[model samples]
Target: MNKPVPPHAPLLEYYEAPAKRSDFVRNLFNRTAESYDGINAAFALGSGPWYRRRALRQAGLAPGARTLDVAIGTGLVAREAAAILGGTRDLVGLDLSEGMLAVARRQLGLTLVQARAEALPFADASFDFVSMGYALRHVADLSALFGEFRRVLRPGGRVLVLEIARPEGRLAHALLRGYMGAVVPALSRLSGRESATLMRYYWDTIEACVPPAEIIARLGEAGLAQVGCATELGMMRAYSARCPG
Candidate 1:
């Protein structure tokens, strides 16, 4: 059953200046890409790898399915998808940062194009599955990006969006806020980074993010079907939906 589309809202409303936020994110990853994996493992309490694998598997991927991984930061999820797809056909990666792509190429040995999530460079219905991990919040327009995602997927193709969100229960949310607002930055600082401001920005962005139900609703409103969501580690969510055939 199809649901009504919610009122559209500006994606950058949470930030006073979207470009500055974008630059901060890009530069943060560029600077810390070398140690990102280690940092994430520590930060997520060693659950990062399991989360990544679970996200990829829940997308209903197969050995030879066409896959497009957007925001392929260091290609962690892409590499997993590639390994699952077994090098058969239709594997591509896209991102806005060349440095991230370089790191991804070195790590995953897959070619990735530099591109924006809202404006992908691909023909209509080009892929069987599209996946993104921890990147949707940076896009300035949710509707535009979802539209592009739907446009690029073939009939019955699925889109998987994995992102961090504030924990739902009041107590959990409070603890998450404190950890993200305080502990994360402190840890980043302890790691000897020049600036831990990026962690602060990350918390703000995730807190401002739309909830999982909203994401599934938006995907359906954008011409997708069979929308569903799965939450992991209480705060991370993977939403999936299929393009109507």
Candidate 2:
């Protein structure tokens, strides 16, 4: 059997065992759900909305497309997608944390489901687009996640996955690490104690995440076609692929 494509190596500092990771992440997000959007806004410097919209549009999100926003924390990516689709009528949001889903329900009028990325509850060929934002590092297996993405997408459907990669330049890496590790967490204290911890854990995951090449390859291996990646500001990566007809 093939080994699982974990987004990051075991984060033993936060969870004692690999099997405990799902519970650890779910609980952490639940605790910080209320403050999640604010912390993201602070870290992204108010450019997240524009950036997400642009990425979605560039990846072929259009009006009338049925979209699924997996791991849709607080409706960040889903909101942008809804705008492009003209409304939330055609969009669905799914996440593992009910706390985050609560916040999303208040922010968006779409259907929300509490579910895991590896095991979507939807039927095959149900969506024209699939999106995941900033939560790739928290998944248990990229292969399983991508397979589900491919399964739920109709022919010619597009999948867009947004992630933050560690910068390749030494100076850039250090600067980003300093900002995310020290500065962001410090500012996040105003949100809550859990918010601060979440920010710190966020940076740790990015630093330890599997490389973009591995991610792209896994998407292709999952029977997706035209898999490619686009980067912005040297750190933000938008991975796009198409479901084969």
Candidate 1 off by > 4 Å? 1-16, 45-47
TM-scores for every predicted model: 0.86, 0.98
Candidate 1, residue 45: Cα displacement in angstroms equals 5.7
lDDT of 1 by residue, 137-232 (tens): 777666777888999998988888888877889998898888887887778776556335656666777777777777776788788888888876
Cα lDDT tens digits, model 2, 2-111, are: 78889989989999999999999999999999888888876883348899999999999999999999999899999999889999999999999999999999999999
In terms of TM-score, the best-performing candidate is 2
Output the number of the lDDT-best candidate: 2
